[model samples]
Target: MAQVASLFTLFTHHAKTFRDLVYSLRNSLLKTGVFTNEKVAEQQVVSVINFDIHLRRDADGHRYIERITECVPVEQEAGYPETFRHKTTTEEKMTAFMETMLEYFRRSTDRPLYVARNVIEYRDGSYVAVHPLSERSRKEIAACLAGPDQAAFEAFLAVHWGDSDEN
Candidate 1:
């Protein structure tokens, strides 16, 4: 079988708030092999480990993900290398990354978190991972936007998508 990158969707019931979830995920990912040596930047709604991986929460607060991506080197090699520089192959690295995440989630909370894995695709000259937001999540988000707490809702949007002026 051909090896490919994997993206995981994480669902947690222990997270009472979005901030709590982001914090937990950041700490957990830092302990993983893939992110241990990398610089992890934690924001209000997203945490990025270098440029190779990112952990973020969906807008509706119904989905979370730790995305592991393949980084292309700026200086391209002329030809295929004779052997891998690292002892572990790409597949092995991905396996370890997945295992570490699963173990962390298992031990972090009493409530079981649903984890779904999907292989990333390179289509039409772009990398793509299909993560369709559910209709329920969409309705919930719309309700929030239409509700009285407009200030809080706008704050949430600013944190995730940045301020409108900046955009």
Candidate 2:
């Protein structure tokens, strides 16, 4: 593979899971006065950290990658599909606002702020891709690819993701 050099930052952490790493970073941002709101701090962490590369050492004293998790940012959609700007009545506006707030509350109750899942894992003494990149992630990658590399990347997506047309 050809190398494209850029800023490559690596550090060792004892986090057992991707969520733990994200939580730690979020708390760090808050305690350092970078962000006051917990939610904002969490979102910032999630967006910034795209991947978590974990490692493990075997009994033989050989260290290898355990898993590579991809941090998928949760799409922050508006609470309600309808906009309250056109609503003239006070009762109607109040109802719309309450409905939006209820949706947000339900989302927090049901799902996490963001998702982190392993895209690659080491099994049977070999590295393997366990999950495919999400559509959003695929698009982001495609956008970053140059025209010369686009065809090859599309072929890779087809083989790996079983997708070709959209990307």
Measured with C-alpha atoms, the lDDT of residue 74 in candidate 1 is 20
lDDT by residue (tens digit), candidate 1, 1-167: 01124232334335543444455765665666546522232221242211223445556764334443321112122343233344378986666666666655654443222222222334454445433322333344556565567567656554544433321
Compared to the true structure, candidate 2 yields what TM-score? 0.72
User: Count of backbone clashes for each model?
Assistant: 0, 0
lDDT of each: 0.40, 0.76
Estimate TM-scores for all models: 0.22, 0.72
Give candidate 2 misplaced runs (Cα > 4 Å): 1-11, 81-102, 108-111, 164-167
Off by over 4 Å in 1: 1-10, 37-167
Candidate 2 lDDT by residue in tens digits, 1-167: 01135333466678888888988988988999969988888887776676789988999999999998888887787446465666889999888878777877887766467778787799998877667777777777778889878778878766765653431
Worst 10 residues of 2 by lDDT: 1-10
Which structure among the candidates has the greatest lDDT? 2
Residue 58's lDDT within candidate 2 is: 92
